[model samples]
Target: STIAERRPERIAGLVYLCALLQPSGATPADLHRHDPDSALVAAIEMAPDGSATSIRPDAAAELFYGDCRPEDVRTAIERLVPEPIGPAMSTIDTSAERWGSVPRAYVRCDRDRAIVPAEQDRMIAEVGVDVVVEMASSHSPFLSQPDALAAALVEIRDGTA
Candidate 1:
């Protein structure tokens, strides 16, 4: 979204997959704070220096890949790494003439624990999109429902979603 907003002329459309879709001037952290049902914030472990955050490995499966295969979950957990706090907390800057003019779409995950369904709906309502596709998958749909995810992406790319 930020990239599109910054260089709308370079991109054709925007497709967010169970992502933090905030309005201008609002950070992703801001949206996560309002989602009381989301389990992601609670599972996050901040570094002592507060420069990074990590999800507890034990909680990873439930929060990110609830519907994924056990093997996939194990693989993902093995590759887990601390995420820098700066980007996650950065506020998005957009304008009606740029971001708003670009066609936007969202692929919502109904079983997501990371972003939660209500939070996803809130974001869709807060920032209107040209398309909204729902899936019976978790936050990590790539691991849980790759086929469906791919199909949705294809439809979005084809402008038929």
Candidate 2:
């Protein structure tokens, strides 16, 4: 289903369901990922490194706003990003607006193609997040550097990163 444009709060309900998916004892695949803290780390560790090709827009119009569409890049975005149209980055707004009410942490991927440092910084400051960790890898550093990702997540977990 298409997002009911502008109905941002429904996204939270979605997140709640996501968290409940793994309520204590569940299979790894059946499990949900959750942290009571609203700390959000876009973990740009694997942010896209943008190719020179034309791109198709992800559901987020913001991503395709200022670029020309190269047929190949357009093909890539469509092919690469799976659906359920997850991540709901649209939910990022909900997380930011409620930052003061919950702990917020951010991990910015140094080589993220989707989010360069400047825009990422703006988002951090705008949200007044509690912590910001920079990981020096493209969008999916967790895949390539689980240790670092684990370390960062631990810091967020222990409140000592």
Which candidate number has the best lDDT?
A: 1
- The residue ranges of model 1 lying beyond 4 angstroms of the native Cα positions read none
RMSD of each: 1.0, 14.8
Worst 10 residues of 1 by lDDT: 32-41
- Count: clashes, candidate 1: 0
- What is the lDDT for 85 in model 1? 98
Query: How big is the positional error of residue 51 in model 2, measured in Å on the Cα after superposition?
Result: 24
Against the reference, the lDDT scores of all candidates come to 0.90, 0.41
lDDT of 2: 0.41
lDDT of 2 at 72: 36
Per-residue lDDT of model 2, residues 1-161, tens digit only: 11212444343222110011121223322211332221122311232443222223443222322232355335535554422323332232232233234454677765554455554565556434566777775445544466887888777768786
